[model samples]
Target: MKDVSGLLERTAQSQGAQPRCPLTGTLMTRGLTVPMDWRRPVTSRERQIWWNADHSFGQIHPRPALDEIPEFYDFPTYYTHDDPNSLDSAEEERRIGALGRLLGSIAYRFERGAEPTVEWWGSVIPRGARNGLEIGCGNGDRMKTFGAHVEATVGIEPDQRAAAVAREKGLEVHAGTAEDLPPAIRARKYDAIVFSHVLEHTMDPILALQNARDLLTDTGILSVEVPNNASTGSRWMGERWRWLDTPRHLNFFTPDSLRACAQSAGLTVRAVLFRGYVRQFMPDWILDEARITAAQQRRAVTQADIDRQVRHSARLLAATAMAAPEKKYDSVRLICTR
Candidate 1:
C-alpha cells in the first residue's frame, strides 16, 4: 500500500500537456481558477465562468496514476466517509440513505443498475433493446430491482463485501475488475452498457469505455454518470474534492473531458445533462479539508457525520431554491450511443 501511495504521489507530480476538447478538438483551459481553501466564499464570477466557458473551470489537469488498473484494488486510507465506530447501525443507515438521496437528486431516469423497471427503460429504449451489462453493480440491489427488465443482466464488482451483498440480492455478480471481465460477460455483446459513477474510478477511461463498446451490439448506447469536474462542488473543493478520492478515483471527467474520452473511444455522446443537485455541507467540508491538511484532524467517515450531512443537505435544498441553482453543483449524467 505504501508503494502504491508513493507511486500515486509521483504520478500527481507528472502533469501532461493540457487535454484537448472533444467538441472542437481545441485545447481547453480553466476560465476561473480558485485556490484550495475551505471557507472561501463561492463566487458568482466562478459560476458564470463555468457556465459560459467551453472547458471546465477548475479541474486539476493530469490526475494522479495508480499502481494497478482497478484503482480500488486497495481501498483508500482516507476516512472521509467510511467510519464504523462514528455512529450506531441505525444512524449509519440514515446517513447511507441521505447520501443515496443526495446522489439520487441527479436527473437520471434509468437507475444505473436497477433494471427490473424495464418498463421505465422500455419506454426510452427503442424497441428491440436486446442485451446490456452493468460494470459495477454495487450491492446488486439495483440490479435485482431492474435485472428482470433487461433480456440479460450481469454485474461486475471487485469488492468481496459488495459482491456478497449483490449475490444476497439475487444478482448474477462476478467478483473481479472490469479489466478482467468474466468470460461470460465478454462473450455476449449488448445494445447498451451502463456505467454509473464507475468510470471515474478506473485507471484508464479510454480502455474501460472501449471494453464496454466491444461488448455492445452495433449502435448500442453507453449510459454513464460521473462527478462533474466542472461542478461548483468540485471547484469549492480542489485536491480535497470529495469526489476526487485520492488513490481510489484515478480519473476525473467533465462534459468536455467525458466527450473527449467517448470520442477517443469511438462512441458518440447523445446527450449530457447536469441536473443532480446537492447544496452540500459547508462546515463538514471545511472540517474535512482541515483534516486533510492537518493529520490530527483526520478521522473516518462516521454515521453521525453522515446524519449531519443529511440534515445539512435538506437545508441546502431550500437554500438552492432561494438562491441560484447549482446546476453544476452535483454529479452529471451522460447518455452515449455507440
Candidate 2:
C-alpha cells in the first residue's frame, strides 16, 4: 500500500482553489462540493440502488420528493461508515467519545476560560427556563452535558442500535428519523431545538427543520452546526476532505442557502459564526485512497494511518486557526430563533 501520510498530504493539497456558489455565482464560504465524488446522482432508481449496492455501508441519496422540494439532482454524501473510513465498532466507539470530551475540555480551558457546560440537552430546561430537544444525539455526548439544566431533554435518532446505546447511558432517546419522528415527540413542545451535523443527511432538509420548529414551544431557539462550504480545507482537500461523506449528505448549505431554508421554515437566522475543530482526520482521508489505489483494490485503513491523520489534522487545524481571520474560513454554527 502507498504511504498514507503522503497520500493525505496530496489529497489535502490537490483542490487548492475555492468553490463558488452554484446558485449565486459567488465564492462559497466553505468547500461544500468536496463530498461530490463519493455521491451517486439522484434518480428514481436510487432506493433500489441503495438496497442493492452496499446499503449497509455506503452513503445513499434519496431522490427529493417532487411536491415539496426541487430535485437538487447533484450533491455529495457527507460521510462514510464502512471500508473507506470505518471507525471502531460500537463497543469501541467510546474512545472517539472520550477524544471528543478531551477536545472539548481543552477548548474550554484555553479558549472559553471556563468549564464548558453540557447545556445542549438542558439549554431550554425551565426553572423559569425552557425545554430542549437534541436531534441526532449520538451517544448522548451533548446530551450528557445538558442533563443538568433543562426542564426536559429529548433526543431523536434514526439508528436503533445507537439509540439503544444512548438510552443505556440514561438519555431519553427515540429511535426514528427526523422525517418519521415518533408522534409522541411531535406532539410536545420545546424551548430549544438543536441540529448538530445532522441536517445534511435528510432528503428534505427544510421539511425536517419545519418539523423541528413544530415541536418547539413559543419563542424557541434553534441551533445548528454545519461544515462550511468555503473553508480552505475543503477547497484544498476535494473529495478526500472528511466532511464530504457523499451519498449520505444530500444537501450542502452556504450562509445564503441556510438563511433561505430557515426563513421558509418560519425560523429567523439570528446569529451565524465560524467555529474551528482539529483537522486531525484529514491526513487519513488521503492515506485511505493511496492505500486502496496502491493495493489496486478496496480495503480498510490501518490504525497507524488513523493515528497519523489525527496528528496531522491537529497541527493543520491549529495553523489554519492562527493564520486565518475568524470570518475568512471555518465551518459555521448558526443560531436561529422563531
**Winner by lDDT:** 1
**Residue pairs with backbone atoms closer than 3 Å in model 1 (clashes):** 83-301, 106-276, 114-142, 115-146, 116-145, 116-146, 116-147, 190-217
Query: So what's the TM-score on candidate 2?
Result: 0.60
Worst 10 residues of 2 by lDDT: 48-57
Candidate 2 lDDT by residue in tens digits, 158-202: 755556667888878886656557776776787777787788766
User: Candidate 2: which stretches are off by over 4 Å?
Assistant: 1-127, 279-319, 323-330
Candidate no. 1 TM-score? 0.62
* Best of the candidates, TM-score: 1
For candidate 1, write residues 192-279 as lDDT tens digits: 6678778876645666777777777766677777777765556644555556544445456677777777777777788765544432
Q: Mark the 10 consecutive residues where model 1 has the least summed lDDT.
A: 43-52
